[model samples]
Target chain A: MRDRINALARLVPVWAVWLGYGWVAPWLIYRGATGGLGAEPIKALERELGEIALQLLIIGLCLTPLRRYLGVNLLRFRRAIGLLAFSYVCLHLAVWLFLDVQDAGRIWADIVKRPYVTVGMVAFVLMIPLALTSNDRAVRWLGARWRRLHRLTYAVAVLGVVHFIWLSKGFQIEPLAYLAVIFALLALRLPDSKSLERRTR
Target chain B: MANRWKNDLRARDVTPEAVYLDRRQVIAGAAGLGLVGTGRAARAKVPEPNAWEDITSYNNYYEFGTDKGDPARHAHRLTVQPWSLRIDGLVDRPGDYDFADIMARMTIEERIYRFRCVEAWSMVVPWNGFELADLLDMAGVQAGAKYVAFETVLRPEEMPGVRYPVLDWPYVEGLRLDEALHPLTIMATGIYGRDIPNQNGAPLRLVVPWKYGFKSIKSVVRITLTDTEPPTSWNKANPREYGFYSNVNPEVDHPRWSQATERRIGGGLFARREPTLMFNGYADEVAGLYAGMDLKTYF
Candidate 1:
């Protein structure tokens, strides 16, 4: 019971950051639109969301690393972080689909014609299955395949990075840092499990 | 593929590969592409003129203001009339074109273009303008003029963004000689039928469709032809993300994300995102300009 409480405690901040990001974005947009914020409120919102999504995903990915390095072993917090990351991304997408385009045909033309949207769409689409299987029942039902399927998160990480990199138009310092973290995490996965254990020790 | 219907009905599969590979009939496939969420909700009537006034006013030029919509609202006080464009630098006809003279010399055509910001969201705006090439020709770009640079009016009184050096003041943007000449590039005077709103780069602006939206410079007070490449505001702010061409190409992803596809605004629930095209579908017309150059490198 004490261990469970500790794990839940570890997840609280991550959830706050995740949920807080969504709640703040529209307010920012409203502020921007109402002359409370600077010139491009919508752009600001889009940027802020993109950034938070990447950061949270990185934080969620870091759970395993945190356990190994700090000996924190907050394994229970993992699902909550993953779910929160998914929630934030869903909100990020909802804002784009509803607020910006407002036209059916033109919006259709853009998704069909534009590439960044394609990669982002693919990333979003792949995420749905992962989210669907996130619960314990779905994981149990799928059994071993669940691990294989959830491996899509790796792709999600890659797509998320690509989505971010392309959105910036130029190299941005923040996304590069996320990429480095992902790279280091992924590089650790390449060597044998014992190798990581040895290094951590 | 057994899932022909699924593949057939997928949005953004307009690429030649999908067109040829999917065994679906062409006409039905085309209709499916267009008709997603057709009867769901009553389509909102296109905003009437000045309908966007409230929204357009708060534009973010970064150099003008950090707020996205700040430029439009703040720029309302800018003196647009009595404006004369200084056509100097590498132009043979290096002189001024009074606002009236420039307006009288050109014919206005309305073109509806999809504007995709590098940020991923997009808007479709109907812009009224004259071909930019016509004006460039009148300016008589000298032989050495390989680039065109534009300068926006900078005043701290109206635009507080000018106070802090987010970018060099009197924001500048540029284009290679040919990209400037592309027919898709325009000197915009009006949008949605009225004068270009102050927030939307009123009085006059440049619209480069193939490129990201910022390539479309707004509220132009000066146009300078240069032999060397001009420093664009976003490019100067972050060179890797905002390139000189800054054209909408899916393959050359921005450093933050892939440009492989974009979400068109107004999509309904379950509406799939569309794939972004190379050269924003102007390859046949403008592809020759880039010829053998490496897009990945230039990008």
Candidate 2:
């Protein structure tokens, strides 16, 4: 009973994350809906969904580092956070597909011809299997292979950053900064790289 | 949605009549160059007059920066004095025309028109310039010429965006011979009865009211009469999103955005969207130019 309470308490921060900016995409979007999204509402909405998805992906990537250094075991919430990221990614693409690009032929042309759209589509494709196999049944069925399959998250994160960089016009530092942080987070996951590991409780 | 406008702003020319008369002479000498067909076709019906801040500050001259607000902030660094225009390629007379010489030969007139961005934002602007057809005639277009290509100045030191590959350096745009010869095509030099600000393509710029705003290349330095179609900057960068013939077709949507409707720039977030018009409401004047051609296929 005591262990159950402790586990529930640890998950509070996770719930906060699920409700906070790291995962509170729907809520933020709801706010934009109520107040209005500026002159070009559809464009603004499309960009917001894409940006929130990126931030959620970054936060999802940081879970391993949190466990390694701060001893905050967020592993329990990783699946939920990842699925949220995927949902946002799907939503982002949906907005672009349905509301923004109404012409079917143009949509195909954009996905095939534009480098930025191609990269973004590739990233979204990489997330589909991860989201589909996220349930306990798939985990139990695949066992060890599930971990291997889910490892594709690393590549998905990298592609997401690339998509952002390519879409931006001019030499913007914000997307570049996201790239740097993502690289650092991935580097921390290296097998022998334990420089930041906490020594004691 | 027609382009025919009946606005009070035309009645209020902020410039004094004395100076207005002095400037009016620029257009007086030109033979048979009437202010493009707004009266005959009566297409555009623009609503509110954009505020001075919106007119001067809100611009998208990507050579200055990609952001709409960046041009007004960054374009001041550009030098417009002693500018020259190169009129060449498939022409009888091909040479560098000094800014003073070009202005001397051209007729300037006020043109209040609806300006629409492919991003689906719209604005109304009053511009002063001469018919581009006059300049094309002055260059003596060869019969073999089938297109008119325009190139913007590339000053990396002054235009910071040029330093980065936001787009190809020296922005280039083109129009078919028939489209280029259209009466609505003007090379704008001023706005609101004053010399155009540097951000709004000071000295000179192309204004094709019937096409997407990007078709109106800014800070123009080169005008070439070409026998073949020319590659445009945005179309070259992302051909899927921006077509070479970026005529304001309400039916053909952009790859990632809708062209059916537009948000008026100053209309606030929740304002009703104004329906987009075919050829930006200049359909009466330009629809025949694309007869038998499928805009969607070319688009």
Candidate 3:
């Protein structure tokens, strides 16, 4: 089963994944521009972009677990997934800055004053270094430090979910569900008791 | 109806039918001309009532569901025909008031007023209903009454949202006696000369123009004249975020978001966010209601 999965993964090109996922941002923009996203299109577009970015982040996090537990190694496409998630995050921020809240001063005020907005901004800022160093050259240059730097993804994931939960009105389950899923994914990454005992021995 | 308050906003001020009915086509055309995000800076000063589609379709009536469109989709299941309102507490003639009888007795009139939401979105609506003062008077408000409390219908089988504790069920809202008695306050029954669609609070709903839209509770089932300030649903849910006196003051920002500006519904995708007015542009008439008090603190 593992060999079959590896063979199938080899058939799909990383460039194909990049091209297919990259089209989502432009497609969402087109829908918003043409009024296909319903009334309050800008808000809908912003939310869709944010959700897609979150999904991509979740998918990117699943790559290692998929390989470890199932021996299904599609690790080659992780870079594309990570870059796509970053691209979607950038699109989400653009829609919010340019379409939703168009005032520069107000945007600054929100980032400084609003707790949810501040959390979201911090997550986005943290993503900048990770995105900048996603290339093979940086991995080769930094060696062990590159993996340490990429661990920022864990902080970004938590902050993103926190931002979602804080911005939601009343007691909503949707954002909380995302929080649960992200927590579960992070928990899966922790070394098991047996593994810890073996390493200590 | 002759003595009724005149409509300062005329029918022409309503969003154009072509623009609303074929909104996508119009937006597509605008996008073709590179005018999509140009903003509404050069437009007329008078606020336009949103299209009937926008008014009825977009709502925060969580009785049906939390999403804005959920009410429109699920409200049809609501039975509004057999509706009756219970008027009790501190009233001389306390009893169940039949909806039909109440409609027949009251003088219904048109009121085009600005409706602002706490989420910094707004719309102008032409509400058709009688002054809430008239209804309270019919129930004979007692001299000891200091506040007016309202309750929304709670049918868990019909209102799917009530199945969950999204908010404490049987959504409640209240206003100080003077605010409830204000002429600007009405029990809205219809929109644009038609019976309000179930989604937009059919049968009966409070329309307090000076307050945030949530304070104007929808599908009201009970009203009580009380001697003490009553707890409101949103306030009960989050005291820091929602206050009892949720008057629309641009200066008092919601803890989570700024209330300084609002995006007008039916203003198209690229229209500029307009600065929110004190009392949602009815400050001249309603500002006196909050005199000698700090709105920021109350908010």
Find the candidate with the highest TM-score and give its number: 3
Q: In model 3, state the lDDT of residue A151.
A: 91
lDDT tens readout by residue for model 1, B86-159: 88998778898997898898877766565777766455556788888889888887888888889887767867
lDDT of 2 by residue, B171-263 (tens): 899999888877788889988777999999988999999899989999899999999999998888887778888989889877655688786
Model 2 segments more than 4 A misplaced: A1-53, A56-63, A66-184, A190-201, B1-46
| Residue-level lDDT tens digits of model 3 in B154-236 | 88888888776789988999999999888888999999888989998888999998899999988999999999999999999
Proportion of native contacts found in each model?
Answer: 0.10, 0.18, 0.55
RMSD to native for every prediction? Answer: 13.2, 10.6, 2.2
Residue-level lDDT of model 2, residues A83-120, one tens digit each, is: 88998898889877866665688689788876779889
Model 1 stretches with alpha carbons more than 4 Å out:
A1-201, B1-36, B39-60, B268-272
Report chain B TM per candidate: 0.78, 0.85, 0.92
State each model's CA lDDT, in order.
0.68, 0.78, 0.87
RMSD of 3: 2.2
Candidate order by DockQ, decreasing, is 3, 2, 1
Per-residue lDDT over A16-82 for candidate 3, one digit per residue giving the tens place of the 0 to 100 score: 9988888888887887766567567778888989988888888988988898888899899988898
**For candidate 3, what is the total of clashing residue pairs?**
0
Q: What is the TM-score of chain A alone in each candidate?
A: 0.78, 0.84, 0.97
